[model samples]
Target: MSAGGMGPTLDDRGARSLLRTIPVRKGPDLQWAPAEPPRRNAAMPDARTSGPTAGRKRDPLIEPRVFEAAVRVYARAGWGGFTFDAVAREAGVGKPALYRRWSGGEELLVSALHNLDFPTARDCGSVRADLLDYARQWVHWYRHPDRALAGRRISLDSRARPALAALYEEMINRPRTEAAREITRRAVARGELAPAVRSSTLPDLLVGAMSTHWESTPEGSRARLRRTFPAYAETLVDIILAGAQAMPPRP
Candidate 1:
């Protein structure tokens, strides 16, 4: 294990607290569509009377832009800040347009979560390699400037909000957890890991380590983090694998 490979020593509460340490920088917001002046009325402009493209039936980009905007807003501000007005302002659309599609922030946030691109881990030749691949993918995705701040915020923000927490489980946790479980199960089948190892908690450890690493690092140093991510990922995987391998078999 590398010098930094002390696998997450924090307990659940400590880890949760650490996850919230890094303040989410609002940063440059997502601006998929061109900005338009706010309209007093919540209703969107009639497609027929709108412009030269009036002949077209609908703006296909509207919902997509709205969805993207909703995510950005939720990521930056969490559940409280995730409002139709906020999404509308970000998406460059009228508030009523959002109301027309979704009933409330929870619904809109769910739709946004649905639209998010979830990363996956493929099976590599070895357990170590497989974990490294997953870790690398996890680091790359969450480290993105577009996602970094929002991802962390949403994670902590979900704790108190049952609805948000459920969405997090459905959209984020379940897939990643399943992938981790598969990796560990494959490892056991191939004799790479002992069956007695606490396989179930492995996902949380790996993800917690990654999240903690992100939270602890200074914002100014994240560019370096991105560049050095491969080495970090390798070390992280090795550390996790080493710990699992070291666990004594249960009688």
Candidate 2:
């Protein structure tokens, strides 16, 4: 991989790449829609009233509620408190229902995360513009509370759990790997980057810089990052490309 922003890792792009499991606002500042209790049909028993027994009835609304509750539970408590009992309580469904759907918290969390929606990447025909857009989008994504929390938790906690680690590989690692390769390949084909330029390095540098900036910044000061990210992204992209140009071709 090249040294600066060639193949950006999914780990760094977690906030940017996550599918909107919940409804999300479009554009650069993607806001998560508020979670509401799934509407109950007139004939269906109130989940709160029926309590655990409510899981006995087959309702289409139940599944979405369970998935949404799972995300919230995982986002708030992370891997430690992400248990069926907790999720069931949050969803107002029985634990048995969760058990039937997933063998454990890892499976449930993965399923929930996978079920979310993701934004498509823009192909501006210029690698510079593409990478800048990616970096800016990542900044906007970090501003989302649930996604940032979930991404942080996954990055830290996945280290301890094998299943969670696998989930990370699937959700974060694989997708970014593909994206980085495509971006670099396009750059090379366009003669913007040397044919021998490392595919992963440049993207890694770009997103790595962005991720480090976000992590190092205190929460109280993030508004500044949000405001300054466009210029910051441009500078980072230019620096990486310039450095990439100076690098000698490797065998």
Q: Quote the positional error of residue 63 for candidate 2 in Å.
A: 5.8
lDDT by residue (131-220, candidate 2, tens digit) is: 877776776667665666676677788888898889767876677567766778888889888877878887789878987888888889
Which RMSD values do the candidates have, in order? 29.6, 28.1
RMSD score of candidate 1 (Å):
29.6
> What C-alpha lDDT, on a 0 to 100 scale, does residue 197 get in candidate 2?
82
> Candidate 1 on 1-251: residue-level lDDT in tens?
44698765667998766565443335576323333434656487765577876654566789989977877887777767777888999999988787777777766776665566555656897788877878877777766555566666677877888887887788776776787788888888898888897556566677788878877889899889888877887888778888999977677
Candidate 1, run of 10 with poorest lDDT: 30-39
lDDT of each: 0.74, 0.76
Per-prediction TM-score, please? Answer: 0.66, 0.64
Error of 2 at 59 (Å): 6.3
Residue runs of model 2 more than 4 Å from their true location after superposition: 1-69, 91-100, 115-124, 248-251
lDDT of 1: 0.74
